[model samples]
Target: MKKFRFALALALTAFVPQGFAQDVQPIDGIAAIVDEDVILQSELDRAVRNITTQYGDRADQLPPVPVLRRQVLERLILVQLQTARAKSTGVRVGEEEIDAALAAIARQNNLTPDQLRQQLAADGLSFSEFRASLSDELAIQRLRQRFAQSSIVVSDGEVDAALANQASGTQYQLANILVALPNGATPEQIATAQDKIDGIKALLDRGEMDFQAAAVRYSDGPNALEGGDLGWRSADEIPSAFTNVVGGMQAGQVIGPVRGPSGFQLLQLRDMRDAAGSGASQNVTQYQASHILVRGDDAAAKARIDALRARVGAGEDFAAVARDGSDDTVTSGQGGDLGWFVHEAFGPQFGDQVSALQDGEVSAPFRSQAGWHIVQRTGTRQTDVGAENRRNQMREMIGQRKLEDEWNRFLREMRSEAYIDIRPAAGVAGVTDGS
Candidate 1:
């Protein structure tokens, strides 16, 4: 029955054609060139159509089609460049991994994989196209991970500073407008960008234009169409350039023409909240758990794990099983006694499974970064609000902030360094350069 369902999904996907792949293909050409790769006009058309489908009701808030086309084209070029770089660096994602990712996405949306394919067909997207897009996204994520791992490092001093500022607790819901300057901009070009930002600030100051309206018209940042909304971010979450300035502003106030690495930035303080009293405060759950680790490859290991799981399921002692069959020396002799530790002390995969188990409940065998194992949740406790725990949490938060900032800067630098050429589309002005 499962095989039949899988075959039926493939059949549906094969029979359903993409809108652009009809009997008569639309006249298509190159939209942009990134290093050795090309972005096709049809791809751009499809992306624009998808965006329109997503935000059609807010059409007035979107930039003009020509401008939107240029922005989307630039984004495509970046993706192509990143994918190529990832491939060059030997980053690979397997079919099994992609399948797992797809299954996870399906579960998130309350649908099966077959239902997901059918929904994509109904929306005029091919399942193959969807998979390919997912693959590219995953590849880009892997590439970013590699870059972040190599480049970002957090220090104790930075963590101390972050904790010191934690008392402020002020988080800003911000909207931004960026008049972006070209990479390696000349003095005159910098001045021109500044003048453009000043004009935008003037209009915003007099209430002639609202923040969203101004953003849609003039912001160069990617979220311009979404009213340049940065959503709710704490001071630590934001880039340093705007941190000092945002602290002084009140809700509904617009302030900027501030110089940044990218260009001139206009910030509107949409709202503010106290993070200390909010849900963002430092708090965590610690779990007391233990597992029997069976290390071997493929079928043999899986069979051993299956038998062990059955033994435990049939009321055999887990500790006895660990002592006899477990490969981990540290815990096997102690009957798999892992002392109380924060969930994050283990990796996310292990942490997630451990968190889901109730006290005194045993999980079915599951695979983690280490190996396949069954985890027993002996107990759980909430961490108290102690100075040491707070300091540890602050250090983690600061490290995350640094990583995010570094990632953004890395992308900017990547775009600047890549060799790209934008070809003009008929009836649309070409994007000659990126900001």
Candidate 2:
């Protein structure tokens, strides 16, 4: 139930620090051979250690050694499979991108880069190893985004219905434990998955096992080790399979062995609350802005935008310069007029640029997916866009749900197609079942 990108990031956190080093180390025993890649026994040991470190005093809550090993190995296999797929599809992470990601990670953890390096060293990790892990993660992230953009389309009618049918402001804090079934699972496999889920449910119902521990031991979900935490989700983001039930469930209630596209899942309503602004006024400050976009390779585009910014700063008319130089044909002809838009109407990059500027002020050039741009904030006004904004929110939520479903199916397919051979000798007991 975890979002694709965030889950991808979490899944590999334990494995990231020494992943690359394990790849070329021939002396270590192989835990699994994934396509052309091998997951080393040493890698599994470090991953397990990292998980225990993460749990700290709660390490007693972790599953038995065998179950934990399988969970960690499966995660590592999936990461390898995904990164391989990303490479096949031509996704690449640049040095600059990795540098930016490192900084962002440091900032998020409230540590400067140097302090972050020190922390990693204290944990016996090297910055280069971390960077290697992040490189694959970034590539896989880009791959997922590209897949979603290409495959998921949210129709206007679907958004309209979602907006009409949903409660205005409710959100649920949910956790899930999934027993995933492979694509086109056989009747026997389905029954096995169902039984496993049912057993998990009985344990939960009888209070024989806590939900988080059950998840860590048995759930095949990406967030299993995180106690299968799905965090807070709006009704729009809930799959239709569970939407009908989640709304009626009380806090702490568990629902399902509910079969879904991915597998049999058990969902727990950890908590529920009204969305902060559900019934609040939708009045928001709207920016009237315009920009000159320069599309090219990153370096060239940045250079061009910077030159345009300097020209404008030297008393060149912004509109005249935009008309002559902007790469966005639709707006360039109209002197790059973007007209009126709210914060994030054009995405966070554009919004951040415009929002940080005063009226009539020109911004420094900034980069976005669309390339580079220098925006001028012409004016600002408070406008209510409640109806439109709600529709947009529904569309995003629906698209996200659909993407998760599709992406999971894709992963299953990838696993089915891959040549994976998990060795019993790799500390996994007699289990040798590998796709």
Candidate 3:
């Protein structure tokens, strides 16, 4: 279950690559293949472009393609898988559901849905695509909750383990100024953005504007209206690129006119804390988990799961297989990788799988909500992989490693059973569902 933590996803934070200087041939990389469908390079690139265009302005740093490829694969696969599962479960997302999700997005960013769309449009994207994407995301979210409600088992022993195993980590709080860049933005346009950020830095230096007010006025991040309060988070929670900027800052210090493919970013460290392992210390506990998805034709999906697990057992690359086959489009490209999970947090099948796995072990294929999964144990840490931290390390190993795979299988089945077909053609104005 190490790789089964579906509930905790890396939120939408990424930097898009520089668009080709001239309109290049339509991207044609074969990122991966899943059964009959293949993930084209263009699709992966576009998704990254979408995330980056909107987040570049706020990100302090962005990773290179090869480095980010796995992550990209994971996310896209999850999206596709979940969308498919939603359809299978007879989960229909109408205009209202789409509207509510959009409203939630707006509220998250402190804007009206119309305003968010206007802003996105200004940046170059179909408001419809965003709506469509949100629907799939929500469907999976609900599916997981339902699974947890019915099957997740938490015990006092698990809680005690969590608290005992929790470790100290560093945390940061910051204010950000994000400037989203549309896909196909030119160098001149990007430079203009950087210069604008420089001006903001100057203004802050001169006490001309405060961080929060500026974020409210100019940042293109989700928390813009809330002054870009990302809340206290651990270093691991942030993009590795920003580690330096966040690491060196003093409270109230403004940092960055950082350059990114999407745009320029400015940041202000508002506060700091050392109690970063709070989740492990306070909230986590062991649970029994089992899941049922409302997605695909269970029989067909199960067949695929059998094939995938077989491949993994035969020494096939788990990440590659996941990227290529997992129905959870959101994270499939990420090689079906889940960052961390606890054993008790996963489904019963997943937990059982974890109990039987050894470090670096890969499981036979399993089915759950999304589709198929070839679960793997990349590595393990018994707290610190040492006797001194054995209890804590074991808990972490249980949570992050053992639970991840099961969670993935659960999600994959859910999404796999879902029925979906992309029009790839036309949509109702401002509506993505083709409704």
Report how far residue 293 has shifted in candidate 3, in Å. 35
Q: What would the per-residue lDDT of candidate 2 be over residues 1-435, giving only the tens digit for each residue?
A: 001122344335444435433233445778899999998888887777768767889988888888888888888888889999999988988999888887877777777878877776665555577778888888889988999999999999998887788766888999999998878789999999888899889999899999988988788898899899988999878876898889889999998888998899999999988786754558899889889999975677788888898899999999999998999999999899999988889998789889999999998888888888888999999987787777777888999999988998888888889999998756764257576
* Two-way TM-score contest, 1 vs 3, winner: 1
Model 3 lDDT per residue over 1-435, tens place: 000111224323332222211123475555555444555666666555554454447532333443334445545556556555556667665777667666766777777877877776665555566555556666766665555555555454864654563444666786678775545568987777777788778878999777876775556554554566767655534433465567778899977777554356777788887763433423332322122221264778777777766666677766776766666655666765665566654567666665566667665556554444445665444332233243554344344432333454465454345432322321111112211
Model 1 lDDT tens row, 1-435 = 011122111122111112323232464887767777767777677666655655658777666889777666656666677788889999998898789778877776778989977776665555676677567667777887787679777778887777776657677898889887766789999988888899988888787888897887678886676678888887777767777778888799877678877678988889998766442435568899889888865888889888888989999998999888898899999888898988778788888889999998998888875778888999988876466765676666666667766765666778888877676762244355432
Q: Rank candidates by TM-score, best first.
A: 2, 1, 3
- Name the runs in model 1 displaced over 4 angstroms: 1-27, 278-289, 293-324, 327-393, 426-430, 433-435
Q: Which segments of model 2 are wrong by more than 4 Å?
A: 1-27, 289-318, 321-380
Higher-ranked by lDDT: 1 or 2:
2
- Model 2: residue 16 alpha-carbon error in angstroms: 4.2
Q: Estimate TM-scores for all models.
A: 0.76, 0.80, 0.35
Task: State the displacement of the C-alpha of residue 124, model 1, in Å, after optimal TM-score superposition.
Answer: 2.7
The CA lDDT of each predicted structure is 0.73, 0.82, 0.55
